[model samples]
Target: MGDVRVIEVKQSVFAENDRRADALRAELKAHGTFLLNLMSSPGSGKTTTLAATFKALRGRLNMAVMEADIDSDVDARAMDELGVRAIQLHTGGMCHLDADMTAQGLRGLEALATPDAPIDLAILENVGNLVCPAEFDTGASANAMILSVPEGDDKALKYPLMFEVCDVVLINKIDVLPYFDFNLERCRERILMRNPHAKIFPICAKTGEGIEPWADWLVASVRAWQA
Candidate 1:
């Protein structure tokens, strides 16, 4: 042993993030706001699915949206066009949003909200990197991910963390399943291995085939969050 002292690092960098996430959750709950953090790979049909979801749930609840990306305000503008309050957050170059970033985004969204039009549900469309987004908690009341048929059934295996952390999983573009070699049963099995209780739904967002049930489940979830 030389004349030097050694220090041990016992806490993880994620520890602080997780702690802040818990606090954000409590704050959101106090306001009766249910924040849903949505994640997926690029081109997962999140926008189309979200559009259908808004159509189904509109006028049933007070809703808002926060679209996060490295650049561009396109999605936020699109959501605003749907008659819902929307905000776009630019990460500058970061790939994921930690609890603090999410809180800041929510604050911006809140400023646009009004007492006559309070938000009961807020959906945060996170940056489109399954791996990075899944590694951080955003204090959402629920977490969900969309997996398109083109992405293949193997995604659940390759991106286990995404499936593991999500409370809900939507298999979008089911109408195109016949054109692909995707195995629905196998994919379900793989996801169940990571999260046995995940509520999985198959939907054709463009065709509006499965939007009603999804919207119903989501509405129930938002109300339950308040309770």
Candidate 2:
């Protein structure tokens, strides 16, 4: 061949993104904001769990939500109807939000905060995908994932990285535990095998069966992060 060229920018790209993510995290901490990047598969009751958290902690803290998805503003609209400061990030076919994308989304959602309406906690409801989302850090102070009872107990074995990276895991839709084949013990054992320090909570988002403790822990963690 007369001329040949090869270029590899993957490492540089990721390094730059990681640098930006660190800066974003520092900026958020300076403003006393705790960003939580929540991930889960579609139909895992992430939105429902968020609603429960809101109800459980309303008027208790300054909170906002950023809903990320491939398309549709349905979740954002739902948050808005609740009178919560919310923004929607459309990934335009991207299955996950990387650090740079998260920074951009935060910029778009900036209008939600002001001196009179400051944000103490900003929840980034990440796109529905256990794979790509778990591979990227969105500069969140804490990360959480939802695993509904209907999703089966073998998820930890199939999606080890997701469970391993999260600080907390919420087992949603526990009201149907009797009907589903989900085994709490087996799931916990598998998750622990991957992430020994993972905090697991079994709850029903619709009825708020076990949401109080989760909400309480969230509030405390936000405070500690701010500190």
By TM-score, the best candidate is: 1
lDDT at position 191, candidate 2: 90
Compared to the true structure, candidate 1 yields what TM-score? 0.94
Which lDDT values do the candidates have, in the order given? Answer: 0.89, 0.86
- 130 in model 2: Cα distance from truth in Å? 0.5
TM-score list, all predictions: 0.94, 0.92
**118-163, model 1: which lDDT tens digit per residue?**
7899999999998999999999999999999999998988998999
Candidate 2's TM-score reads 0.92
Q: Which candidate is the best by lDDT?
A: 1
| Runs with alpha carbons beyond 4 Å of true place in candidate 1 | 1-4, 72-77
| Segments in model 2 whose C-alpha atoms lie over 4 Å from true places | 1-13, 70-77, 81-83
